[model samples]
Target: MSASTAVEKVNLREALLTRRRARTPAERESAAEAIALHAAALPALARATRVAAYLSLPSEPGTGPLLAWLAGRDVPVLVPVGRADRSMDWVEHTAGAVESGPLGVPEPSGRPLGPGALATCGIALVPALAVDHAGNRLGRGAGYYDRALADFPGVVCALVHDDELLPHVPHEPHDRPVDLVLTPAGVFRPSRDRDV
Candidate 1:
């Protein structure tokens, strides 16, 4: 990225993180429920027996209710295990499987299914600070999700706050665009001129 774009991304990340930190506990919980409700209604989730998703950090949209809802429906979910190299490993989500892991990210303790297993997922629910109308995602400055999903074919959705769905975000060639963005309001498909 050029110097101007790099500076813009840093400032945007800071602003978004600050907004996340300011959310009250009750507001966070309510938002999580709303997000899960909207996401669960998707035909993709309804048709899938398995999905790839993440257990959220406290500062982001709480995914606990969604995970539990998936489990209840007998839809097994695979969560990302942060690796030393910043690549992701997949772990099957079982009851009470998540624990605090590297970089304070919530992780599953089940047997790893490895990165290649992502191809089997009907849809992927990823985490992001913000996403643009053009489908550019602003992750937490780590390329783990982008690298892990380099060639994934299924629909990829980033869970973000309603206000986090911005008009634009600085992106590079290495960035992997998402097919959809889920927020407390509903599911939104970024308006890309061409299909990803």
Candidate 2:
């Protein structure tokens, strides 16, 4: 990536993180509820027999509600456990199957299902700092999701706050794009020529 693009990503992540950290507990709870409701209504999520999702950090939009909602419906959920190679491994997110993962991120506490497990998921709820109008997603800079999703053909959704769904965000060629952006307000389906 160009130096300017890298710089832009770093600056954007910092700005977004600041905004997330400033949210009050009540706002977080409300956003979490909205996200869960709206996301659950998504056609992809609604139809998927199994979906891949991650636990949200305190600052990000919560995924616990969505996970529970999915599990309650008998829809299996796969949660990521970061790997040493910057790849992601999946595990069934059953009750009590979460523990403090790398960098304190909550992850599935079971044996990994390996990177190939993502293929079984029809949709994925990925965390993002922001998503651009063109469907480009700005992640937390480790490139873990990008690498893990390189060959994934499922519906990719990024869970972000309403304001974070911007018209533009700097991106590199290696960055993976999301097919949908699920915020509290609604879902943004970017124009992409793909059969999801």
Task: Please estimate how well model 2 matches the true structure, expressed as its whole-model Cα lDDT.
Answer: 0.89
> What's the lDDT for all of these models?
0.90, 0.89
Model 2, 104-194: lDDT tens per residue? 9998788789889999999989999999888999999999999989899899999999999999999878888999999999988877876
Model 2: which residue pairs collide?
Answer: none
Residue ranges of candidate 1 with Cα displaced over 4 Å: 193-196
- In terms of lDDT, model 1 sits at 0.90
TM-scores of the models, in the given order? 0.95, 0.97
| Prediction-by-prediction clash tally | 0, 0
Query: Residue 177: error of model 1 in Å?
Result: 0.7
Q: Considering summed lDDT, which 10 consecutive residues are worst modelled in model 1? A: 187-196
